[model samples]
Target: MTASRFPRWVYTEGGEPDPRFTLANERTFLAWIRTALALIAGGVALEALSLPIQPGLRLVASILLLVLGLVSPLLAWFGWAASERALRCGRPLPSSRLGLLLAVGVAAVGVLVLVGVLVGPVGR
Candidate 1:
């Protein structure tokens, strides 16, 4: 209930005081969840398409999606926590290295899949 608990001024006119910052943070978290779901769907599609699916490679992709899905909510919560703290303390939001890390990881998996398809058995 205290002003220190949330960023209410981020949303108000002239920055006099508002709750827009918290609102924005919530929106961001929702976007992350959507991204996680998309990744999961991609993994499912890979499995459904009968890709080479060598046990190890398939497992990697599946685990990537599963981990992403599992971590999304946790990341979102952390983001909210940081946002709240930043707003209260009048400090900048925390930097996020995970976004870049996730992007690179996903790209790596895609490349692995491509390589597998190229080198895999052709008569399957």
Candidate 2:
């Protein structure tokens, strides 16, 4: 009996890639997931903790972090699939499109936190 892989779409088309490369791709996916979890934790912490920052800015930063967290898993899945497909098809690995966006978002969150800290709690 043939054991079927879960993602038939990814498994069906291309030749099998080296196990090492596939393992590496899986590791990358896990790393992205870890990052997503960290983002989510940060978002939760911002709201749950009573830090002395502007509430509005803190909420915005938290929302942005949560959004990034939500999107990271999609990036991880699509990135792993695309890379695995390319490896199987002997094509060059595709460059990440959303990575830059995520980086910018994280930077924006940092800036917002900085501004909130600097501005302090207003009208509290």
Candidate 3:
């Protein structure tokens, strides 16, 4: 039995390599899973808060949170796939487009919330 030099299967149609890359890939997958779970948690927390919230606001928040939760995992999977491909190709890691998009989306959501607060009635 002999360990291979490069990350296998990636280079050849069917080959094996050091386990380090495999472990790294597993870690990346776990990170993505955690991210996905966090998004789901956020959705649940938002819905939970809705218990005492006005129906309309609660519904809107719940919907938005659920969308975030559902999308985060998909985005994570897409990003991970691209990253893994880059690793296999030995190319410089792809740009952080996903991170930037997430950041922008979050900021836009914050702005929308601010607008809602400002445009809506003053607190009771």
State which candidate has the highest lDDT: 2
lDDT of 2 by residue, 25-60 (tens): 899899999999999999999988999999999999
> What is the per-residue lDDT of model 3 for residues 1-124, given as tens digits with 9 covering 90 to 100?
2225333433443334346764676587677667657767765775575244444554465566566667767776666555566665666556644566556655655555555555553353
Q: Which stretches in model 1 have alpha-carbon errors above 4 Å?
A: 2-17, 52-55, 122-124
Rank ordering of all candidates by lDDT, starting from the highest = 2, 1, 3
Clash list (residue pairs), candidate 2: none
lDDT of 1 by residue, 1-124 (tens): 3445344453331323247876786788788878778877877776667666465676677677667767766776676666666765677889753587578768877876776666674545
Q: Which stretches of candidate 2 lie over 4 Å from their true place?
A: 1-3
Displacement of the residue 32 alpha carbon in candidate 3, Å: 2.5
TM-score winner between candidates 1 and 2: 2
Please state the error at residue 95 of candidate 3 in Å.
Answer: 2.4
| Model 3 clashing residue pairs (backbone) | none
Candidate order by decreasing TM-score: 2, 1, 3
